[model samples]
Target: EELNMDLFSNCMDTVERCLRDAKMDKSSVHDIVLVGGSTRILKVQQLLKDLFNGKELCKSINPDEAVAYGAA
Candidate 1:
C-alpha cells in the first residue's frame, strides 16, 4: 500500500481548521480520538501530533472495533 502525503496533509489541514473554527486551542486537546480506518496508519498519528504540537495522542481502542462501538 502506498502512503499519500498530499492526502495526509489535507487531512491534517482539515482537522486544524476544524479545531480553529471551534475556537479550541490545540494545547487543550489532550486526546486525539481518531476513529477512522485511515488513522490506523502511523503517518496519520504522526501528522496529528505534529499539527497539535506534540500533544499526547490516545489510541488504545481497537481501530476496527472502536468505530463500531462509538457508532452504536
Candidate 2:
C-alpha cells in the first residue's frame, strides 16, 4: 500500500506536468492509455480512474507489447 501510494504520487505529478506542458486540461483528454507492466497494479489503475473522474482506460494494446507496437 505504501509503495502504491508513492507510485501514485509520482504518476499524478507526471500526468499533471504533461497536461500542463501541453496546455491541455484533464477534461480535454479523451483516453488514458496505460503502458508497461507496472500499470497492471490495481492501485495504479484506481488512481488513474479517480484522476480522470472514472473515465475508462484504454487497454486495447497488450501492456507488454505496447513498446514494440509503438516502435513498429
Candidate 3:
C-alpha cells in the first residue's frame, strides 16, 4: 500500500506539473493519455480518474508499444 501510494503521489505530481507548464487547468484537459507500463497500475488509474473528475482515460494504444508507435 505504501509503494502504491508513493507511485500514485508521484504520478499526480507529474500530471499537475505538466498542467501547470502548459498553463492550463484540469477542466481544460479534454483527455488523459497514459503511456508507458507504469500506467497499468490500478492506483495510478484511480488517481487519474479522481483528478480528472471521472473523465475516461484513453488507453487505446498498448502501453508497451507506445514508444515504437511514437517513433514510427
Candidate 4:
C-alpha cells in the first residue's frame, strides 16, 4: 500500500515538473500516450487519468515493444 502511494506521488511530482518546465498547462495537453514497462502499473495509469483530468489515454501501442519501435 505504502509503496503504491509512493510511486503515485513520485509520478505526479514528475509530471507536474515536466509541465512546468515546458510552460504547458495540463489543459493544454490533449493526448497522453504512455510507453515502457513502468506505465503498465495500475497506479501510474490512474495517476495519469487524474492528472489529465480524465482525458482518454492512448494505449494502442504495446508497452513492451515501444522501445523496439522507437529504435526502428
lDDT score, candidate 3, position 47: 91
- Candidate order, lDDT descending: 2, 3, 4, 1
The clash numbers for all candidates, in the given order, read 0, 0, 0, 0
lDDT of 3 by residue, 1-72 (tens): 685687679879999999999999999998787788888988888899999999999899888888888899
Q: Where's the lowest-lDDT run of ten residues in candidate 2?
A: 3-12
Q: 1-72, model 1: which lDDT tens digit per residue?
A: 245878988888899899899999888786777776888888888888888888767778777788788879
Candidate 1, which segments miss by more than 4 Å at Cα? 1-3
Worst 10 residues of 3 by lDDT: 1-10
Candidate 3 wrong stretches, greater than 4 Å: none
Which candidate leads in TM-score? 2
- Worst 10-residue lDDT window, candidate 1: 1-10
Candidate 4: tens digits of C-alpha lDDT, residues 17-46: 999999999999977878878898887898
**RMSD of each candidate relative to the true structure:** 2.4, 1.4, 1.5, 1.6
**Candidate 4 segments whose C-alpha is farther than 4 A from its true place:** 67-72
Per-residue lDDT over 1-72 for candidate 2, one digit per residue giving the tens place of the 0 to 100 score: 885687689988898899999999999999888899988888888888898899999889888998898899
How high is the CA lDDT of each candidate model? Answer: 0.81, 0.88, 0.87, 0.87
lDDT of 4 at 69: 83
